[model samples]
Target: MLRRMFAPEGPTFRELAVQALSSVEHGYDLLAPKFDHTPFRTPESVLAPVSRALRELGPFGSGLDLCCGTGAGMDVLRQVCRERVTGVDISAGMLAVGRARETVPARAPRMEWVRADARALPFGPVFDLVVSFGAFGHFLPGERPGLFAQVRSVLRPGGRFAFPIAAPSRPGSAAYWMLAGFDAVMRVRNALWHPPFVMYYRPFRLSDVRAELARAGFAVRLHALPELGRRPDGSPRCRLVVATRAEAV
Candidate 1:
C-alpha cells in the first residue's frame, strides 16, 4: 500500500489517471519514464534469486525477455545465456528506456530490443530460454492459452519458458480483499471508460495457468523460488513455473 505513495520520479495521480484512460500500450508508454521508480517494476529481491536459479539451470545459447518492461529480466539472462539476449514489448517507450539500460560484459551476448506484441512476436523458434516478470495481469483470462502458445512458439525444442508466480492470497485475508477490490474497481472503470485498461489481479490462478500451458504444448514444472519463502501451510509463497517445449521424437 505504501509503495503506491509518492516517489521522487513517479507519475502523479493526474498523470496516472490520464494514462489509465488510454489503451494498455499507450498507458505503459506514458508510464515508462518513471516506471522503474514506481512499484510496478519487478524488485531486485525476486530477480536476484530467480537469476541464481536460472544460472543453475542454464548456459543457454539465447534468451528472450517476453513482455520485458524496462528489461529488468535481461540482467538475469545476461548472466546465464551465452549467445544472444533480446527484450520484446509492445511499448516503444518501455523499449527505449530498456535500450538505454544495456550493460555489456567482457564477453557479452548479443543484445536486441524489439518492439513487438507478445501475441504476434516476429521470431522463429530460436530462443533457448524465455522469461517474463510482472506483466501477466495485462493479459485477460481468455488470452492465456494464446499467450502461452506464443511463448511456446518462440522456444526451440526442449527450451524453457519460466516466470515466478505468487500463490494466491488466502480468502478473507487483507491481501485477497485488496486484490479483489482492485479488480472490482478496474472492472467498473473499464465499463465506464474507453479503450479498456485490461488488467485484473484475480484472474490468473496457478491451476488454470498450468492447464493452459499444458494445452499450449508445454510440459510444466513448478519449483519453489525459496527466496520468496513458504506460506504458513508450507506451500511455496511463490513458485517458478518452468514450461518446456517438447523435444523432437
Candidate 2:
C-alpha cells in the first residue's frame, strides 16, 4: 500500500524534499501539478463517507471550503449545497489546479476559487456550510483559536464548519512512532530552516478542537462515519466534526 501510494507517478523524493525546503506557498506552487498523485492527497475512502454524511445534513445554500487544497472538499459541497460552492486557499498554484480540474453539471452549483490566508479570510457571514479536508497539519498549534474564529466569521448564523479527523494511532504502535518521528523532524527542520513547511502528523487533538470551536461561538457536534469502519476496540476509526455557528453569532 505504501509503495503503490508513493509510486513513480507521484512526486519523487528529490521533488518532495525541495518542496519541504521552500516556503509553504512557494512549495505548494512547485508541487501543484503533481499533488493529487501524492500520498498526501485525501483518499476516496474518506471523501466518499464525508460526502454521504454532509448530504444528510443538507440542502445547504452557499458552501465554502476553507484551506481547500486542490478542492477535494468541493466534491462534498457539490453533493450537498444548493446554490454555490467556493474553494479558498493560500496557494495560488493549488487554486489554479482546482479551477482547471473543475467540471460542473448545468444543475450543479456554481463554483469559484479564491486565494487568501485562512487566518484572515476575505469573506463575510455568507457561507451556509464549510468543510476542509486533510489540511489542518499546515497550521501550528497556537493558530487553532484564531483559525476557528476566522471560520466562524465567514459562516452565516447557524452555518456549519465540518472536517474529518481520524483516531490517533495507539502509543508504541509503528504508526504512532512514525508520526512522532515525523513531528520531531518537522520541529528540527523548522528550527534550522528559513521557511518552515509546517506539516505535522499529530497535535490536532479532538478535545482541544471542540473546545476551541466552542470558544469561537460554534456549537459543535460529532458524527461517526461508519463506512470508514472501527478499530479493534470497537471505537470509530474516523469521525466528522461539525461545528455550527451559533445562531446569535
Candidate 3:
C-alpha cells in the first residue's frame, strides 16, 4: 500500500523498527524518508473535511501550521491566508522533505518554515489561524498544556487553533482492539526503553483536550464534519476542534 516501496531511499524493516524504538524527534527523522508513503501520514480524507470547515470560518490574514510534519496543513493555510503562511516543527529531516514538495500553487501566499519545538514556538501574536494534523499523539498528556499555550502565544487575539479529531472506536470492535494492542505494546516499550516516543492512540480524549485548551486560555468549540459520516451511536465520526483565543483588552 506504500508508494515509498518503489522509492530509491525507502526504509528497510530494521530501520523502521529502530525508529519505533527512538524518541519522537529521531523517530520522525528516520521515518521522514518514507513518511508520505506510510498510512501514518494524515490522509487526504481528513484534510478535505478540515479545509471545508476552515473555509467557512476563514479568509484569515496569516496562518501557522504547528507540528507540521511534511507540511500537509500548509496547503490548507495557503488556501486561506492572504498575507503569509508558516510551518513549524522540530524535525529538520521532515522539514527538508516538506520543503521539497510542490504542493503549494505559485500564486499562493508567501511561505516560511521554522525549526522549533511545539512546546516553545519562536513567534509572537502574529497569526490569525493555526492548524495541526495527526501530530498530537507525539506529546505526553502532561505536555498538552504547555503545547497548547505555545500555540496560543503565536495567535493574535480572536485567532483559532483548529484540528480534526476522530471518534473513539467502540469497545470490542476490530479497530478498538487494534488500537488497544498498539497502546499496550507502546506502554511496554516505553517501560523498557529510554527516550520514549509517547505516541499512544487512546489518551487524546476530546473532553480532556477541551479542558486543557481552556486552561491555556482558549474557548473551545466542536464542529462535526458530516462528510466523514457518523458512528453507530450517532456521534460524529470526526470533529474539528476550534479553539479561539478571546481578544485581550
TM-score winner, 1 or 3: 1
- Give residue 240's lDDT in candidate 3 (0 to 100): 99
Which pairs clash in model 2?
none
lDDT of 3 by residue, 1-249 (tens): 345543556677777799988889999998897888777778788888899999999999999999988888998888788999999999998999899884656678988988999998999899999999988988889989999988888899999999999999889999999999989999999999988878886999999999999888999999999999998878899999999997641
lDDT value, residue 40 of candidate 2: 75
Which residue runs does candidate 3 get wrong by more than 4 Å?
1-10
Q: What is the overall TM-score of model 2 with all chains considered together? A: 0.97
Off by over 4 Å in 2: none
lDDT of each: 0.90, 0.90, 0.89
Estimated TM-score per prediction? 0.96, 0.97, 0.94
Error of 3 at 52 (Å): 0.6
- Candidates sorted by TM-score, best first: 2, 1, 3
RMSD for each of the candidates: 1.4, 1.2, 2.1
Candidate 1 TM-score to native: 0.96
1-249, model 1: which lDDT tens digit per residue? Answer: 345545667888888889889999999999998888888889998999899888888889999999998999988899899999999999999999998877787899999999999989899999999999988999999888889888888899999999999999999999999999989989999999989998887888899998888888988998888888889999999989999997632
Give the Å error, residue 124, model 2: 0.5
Position 97, candidate 3: lDDT: 88
